[model samples]
Target: MTDVRVLIVGGGLAGCTVAKMLEDEGRGGDVLIVDRDPQAPYDRPPLTKAFLGPKDRMVQSPPWAPADVPWLADCAVAVDLLARAVQLASGRVLRAQTLVLAAGSLARDLPGRDNRVLTLRTVSDALRVREIRSGGAGCFLVEGAGPLGMELASTLADDGASVTVVDPASAPMERLLGGALATEVASWAAEAGVRLRLDTKVVHAVPVGDRHAVEAVFSDGEAEAFDCMITAVGSVPAPMMLHGSRGAVGAAVVDDMRRLVDVDGSHFEGVFAVGDLAFHRDADRSLVRSESWTAAKNDGEAVGRQILGLPAAAEAVPYFWTRQFGRMVQVLGAIPLGAEVVPIAVVPKTGGMLYQASIDGSTVGFVGVNAQRLVAMLQMQGGAVAEWVAPEV
Candidate 1:
């Protein structure tokens, strides 16, 4: 068995970022990254955006220099935390002084894993979807109304496919954006000609005939056939590698320092959990697992700094944005459910709207539609809402 100073189990944004940070701090030779995908790591956000469009829109991360850091194109099938060793699918065993679990997550599968159903979570998945679009598949049915579903639906519609988005949520992204913003987004989606079937679900999907289509059965016993079906029902953390380890690996528990917590709620030395697999206990004692790109990057960087014996950077406010229906929707901070959503500004000429979200008379967050500049300014000048003034629109 080969041994190294550090072993990172994923090569996605979080894992690669950690490797780069470590190398930049003059620890390149001590790190090894193992990823199941043989291809070099690339940015994933564009997969749902530009990469699905024109042929020239290629989305790839900047190439890593020094090329000497070992990146094993293998999957970690099991882990022995007590012995600090990981077993790969190819039967190779690796041990490390410190283990970083950044395995990321997989796209949640649909109810029916039929041949006609697809989900976009990787480069290969995106390519397969692009191929389907190029093949002139019409009448696309998208399951789930999350950001991925909406983005993919818009992309498919742009590609000349009649698209329909069905979700069991009362409104698209209601749990995340609250009812007001969700209703606004639903209206925007309708104006874009993409049909929204709110509070609806697909019971099952089955292949109809030789045309490579799927007939989806709804909750109301209504059946509809489409040339293709894409499910974006979110993702679940990929932490199976840490399972069945006799309480040595705790994939679901993490402390503020990103260290893996044992079954007894104690931190495990030299074992860190970051990215989607990390369930961080906030100051409020609530466990939060953020799946956004920014959150993953911050998690990796913070853990890397901690490993290097450097002072951890101050945590930045959580941020997420998406492009859909010819507008940019951005959210800053966590807007809890039942929060008071007050319209702060609305500019029809610039197609911008800003809402101040409060809880019990205290500002908690801000949601903006096509108001990136305002949101960024507010984030930079962080303070209570009492002193802030909404721009006259």
Candidate 2:
């Protein structure tokens, strides 16, 4: 009889974490990891902040890895669910008892955007950005105020280039951080000498003489131009492989514990899903699909526990952070529905702000800038904000 195995697709954070855990558990037999990139898995966070370096280089390995594990450096082409096999782009087939998808996502370029634009999703993309920006002070414009775009903006500004960040929203990070913290971030951007263009939209981009410029017509009909454009709008799951698979929803399907694949509901058979791809048809699906790395890593660990037939671990606080203009901002836990925002504290010396988001008089979440240690401290004390009103600092 052929031995059963595990096949993990997309060697991003989730896939690699799961593979390493399986290997450590002596389940490495017949385990295979397939990914499109040839290089060993490395830290993607450095692709933005660290590479902008006064003292940055590729550095060393991250916290996780199983040195002897088997991996195939090929993109997955198809999932033969019936045969329990994964098909690679090179026409190779590998059978497994379990298949995991951590294929991740690609940036969602605007309607008229093309290859002339740059993205920061992978290590190679980051290297290209460094090479182009390092040539000298070049005009840089970043679209969106999310983590990737904001970090890139900070990197460029620190290198002595005039940077302009344009977003269609009224404030820099309202969607993720709420209005109070967003205003604080906008203030920090101005103080750090980064140009801000809010409620702005791009109309068209064209090459002019020796340089490229995008003719952007903002919502107010003000036209603007920029030499280089970078986008960090967001990402969608790379779900092409699940188009014809049974029991799949869009790019992936999830179970009660948020595993990725479709298991037999009746018999409770084995299957799993993780990362950005996990979803449910319930009311909160939209927010559950944030696609951030923090979400992906937590889902990865959850699925690992499930494979071992252990009870699912408690869901994490669901956090994500960005370092821009040397200020650290993070969002922890779910944003309460119709929550009113209140200012907790703002340190003028460091430009860090802490705000509590409350709904129906209960603190549901908090957004902090340069206050990660403080935020963790708050969460550790039985959800600190709930215990008492803010004491004057």
Candidate 3:
């Protein structure tokens, strides 16, 4: 058994952010980050974009976090919440005063299984995908129309490779942009020669005979065989070391402060959860689970502040973005379907527009298509973006 001041389980953006915060405050020696993944904490956004394109670079750690920040390459097998103790795979028990569960999530697979089938979630996955692309795997089957799938498809298409994206959603990111706007975005992607098969799911996937190719059959009874197949179906919370202790769900349920809260509404004093694994409770009493990169970093900031008793930063609006074909779509806050949209800017030539969306007469979200300047103004305003972009007449 060993004693630690702070034990951060996971080395993704959220965990690394907290580690960086501590190191900035001269507490680096007291923090121990346990992660199974070999790569150091890195910015994940570029993995699907530039990393897969030309640079092939991994944004490992924030600039402020020096090379010496301690990280233990191990797996946490179990957790004892009351004792604040975690049992590692090597039979070592680490007891800490503060526990931060930033264990992120892993990609969910399709119906059938084959190790050859690819899914990009880690540095290794990206490298493997890159290697294959470099080897001339031109025809690609991208399963799932989520941001990840779309980003990968775009990257390949830009390289003059054939990309076919299949997903169960009615449109690309239909849940985020609504059918109307999502369809419009898909149209732009079409211009780049990216084939989209929406409202479809892969019922089966199998590697074609000795050849380095895979054939996937969609629910629509259509089958396509490609040189390579990748699935970005979505992600499930990584297996953390919690077992519903104290009436807690088998999830990292946390409140607005990112503090772990029991299902019965009780808080665990020095314990918190951040990143994709956290099921966060908002002011509206809604349990929102966001997989946005911005949200993960923001959660880490909030947790780091709380851990050091520092004053909280301004409340950050939830954000998400995707650069598919000829468009860069940005979403700030929550924009539900049927929300009132007030267009602020529009580029008639490219069909790019920036708009503010609201529900019940109160601004709640902003959507921008190829409007970076307008989007920045709204993002910088955070909750007050509504005022910055006054309602159109």
lDDT of 3 by residue, 1-393 (tens): 899999998888888888888888888888999988877667777788875654436754555343557788888877777677888888899999999988899999756758878999988888888888888789998988877888889888998899999888887876676543775768767988999998888888878966458888889998888899888888998885674456325778898788888667777778889999899766677877889878888888898898888999987777798887867889887777777767767866666788778878887778888877677766665556455554222
| Ten residues in sequence with the least summed lDDT for candidate 1 | 57-66
Candidate 3 off by > 4 Å: 53-56, 59-61, 64-67, 244-249, 282-286, 340-342, 347-352, 382-393
Q: Write the per-residue lDDT of candidate 1 for residues 116-199, one digit (tens) a residue.
A: 698888877888888877777888899989888898887777766799999998878765676557778878878778999988
What's the true lDDT of residue 142 in model 2? 86
Better of 2 and 3 by lDDT: 3
The TM-score ranking, best first, is 1, 3, 2
lDDT measured at residue 330 in model 1 versus the true structure, 0 to 100: 85
The better candidate by lDDT, 1 or 2, is: 1
| Model 2 lDDT per residue over 1-393, tens place | 222477777777787778777777888765677778776577677777866663235434566655667877887766655456666778777767877777777777787776666777776777666777776537877888766777778888887777888887776766676544566677777776788887776666554436444555566667666667788787776654642334543446676665544344321234466666555444654535656678778777777777767787666666777777777777776664356777688757676667788878887677777776667676565533456344333
Candidate 3 worst ten-residue window by lDDT: 384-393
lDDT of each: 0.80, 0.68, 0.80
TM-score per candidate, chains pooled = 0.92, 0.87, 0.91
| Model 2 spans > 4 angstroms off | 1-4, 54-60, 210-219, 243-249, 261-269, 281-287, 336-338, 345-351, 381-393
Candidates, ranked, lDDT: 3, 1, 2
Candidate 1: C-alpha RMSD to true structure equals 2.5
